[model samples]
Target: MDTDADARVAAGVTALSERSTERAGDEFTRAAWLSLADPRSDEELSPFADEDRGWVGEGLRWLVVAAVSYRVAGREARASRRGVEGIAVARDLQTTRSHPAQRACLDEFVADFRVAAGMDDADAAYRTAADAYREAGDAVDDPHRLATSPLFRAAAAPIEQVARGPANGEIAVEWDDLHGSDPSDPGAFLARRATYKRQRFPSLLDRVVDAGRLAAPRGTTEYGNDSFRCPDCDSTDVNWIAGRTLCLRCSAPMARA
Candidate 1:
């Protein structure tokens, strides 16, 4: 990801962390901390056996291929191979520039880095990631800005449904209760607005879930309700989740049904 985009995601993570800490209560935070402490048990990295192995699986396959190819290749093939691999992962995640600018920003970085690597220019690659990220920032549309830009609706398609519900409002309230954001205050309004903006994208959520930045609930079908899976683990059970179901064991997310 580009610096600016990374910064934005970082900012969102910070917000999510704070909110999680505040609203999820000490129990949730402690559990999350414990999970973080034990990366192996960390729910983030835990295998979702029930998940469908469709585009996401394909993307992962490409990622492995790309990474292996990069590692095995001489310096000449490094940049392009890695770049394509990064894009492959993004595509697998179903991220697109049209909807989630933040995601697009990161993908742009992967693309830029590939070019830099090809040119044998490290600084250029980094700068490209940074510039592209900055440019992408202009396209961002969070909940507060959603009404003004329907583009956000499409980008947020995956997560907006979750974020807009009363549940998220509860989450937001929980955030204020702990962090002390005064909803009635104008200055606090901007902070809240930006905070929600930073936190409200499905693509962003996916990245965090992948990166282990957020705590995902275990038995919730919200994770993989769109796909089918083995009654056991999601693996490539059928190469896709046959039903919009979740893992029965851990409630891990999936996309097959």
Candidate 2:
């Protein structure tokens, strides 16, 4: 039977099929963390234990989509949130159980995240160090140092630096409002709240158009849907104001005659 990339990484079976077993476990573990963080299906999780589960599971992905609906057409915040969430999910998955090959993959993946997150979040560094310790064992006890490999130790160095750096007071919630809410079930209260917010911000130019009571000239569709109707006169005769549609008859200034 043909197994997917995830199955190969999680089980370390595919890595061994292609590469050496020495660090196959770590490599597989890394792959699992990275994949789980981005996105996956229930079928994919079947091979993994509880520890391998995604950060918030697949449900949170939907919530993220809902959140993006509130932001502008293409804001950076939305994209950044998605990227960070992926990293967070992967970090959670890395600590999960894995075969020898899978474990090595995970170590490398964890090491990579540690370096990235260290740029901003200090806690990430400490977490990486702890993971390496668990893998390698105590410094005094490990003589041949077979318990954990050098790569594991190398991954921990940068993490330690992060822990010492100045701390930022920013909070890291997946979705502030979506918390304690279910993304799978449409009826969830958070989902309802999100819906309301989406409706409130329907378009960026709603008010200036005056209750959407106006529209642009028939020939002018330069702004596309951004055009608005004059709210006061209830006419299509409106002008763009602060990126909003405003009625020319109501508050719009006439051109110099």
- Candidate with top TM-score is 1
How far in Å is the alpha carbon of 64 misplaced in model 2?
17
* Tens-digit per-residue lDDT, 118-217, candidate 2: 2243244334433443343322232223212332222222222122111110111113222124333322322222232222222212231123221111
* Span of 10 residues, lowest total lDDT, candidate 2: 164-173
Runs of candidate 2 with Cα error greater than 4 angstroms are: 1-47, 50-79, 98-119, 122-127, 138-257
lDDT of 1 by residue, 1-257 (tens): 23232232233223332333122222322232232233233233322222221112222222222232222223335435544655544444433234333343334334333432243443343344334434444443332343123222222222322232223211222333211143233223222322333333323333433333232221123323434554435432221121223233322333345
lDDT of each: 0.31, 0.30
Candidate 1 off by > 4 Å: 1-65, 68-96, 100-103, 106-119, 141-257
Candidate 1: residue 196 Cα off by (Å): 24
Worst 10 residues of 1 by lDDT: 50-59
Q: How many backbone clashes does candidate 2 have?
A: 27
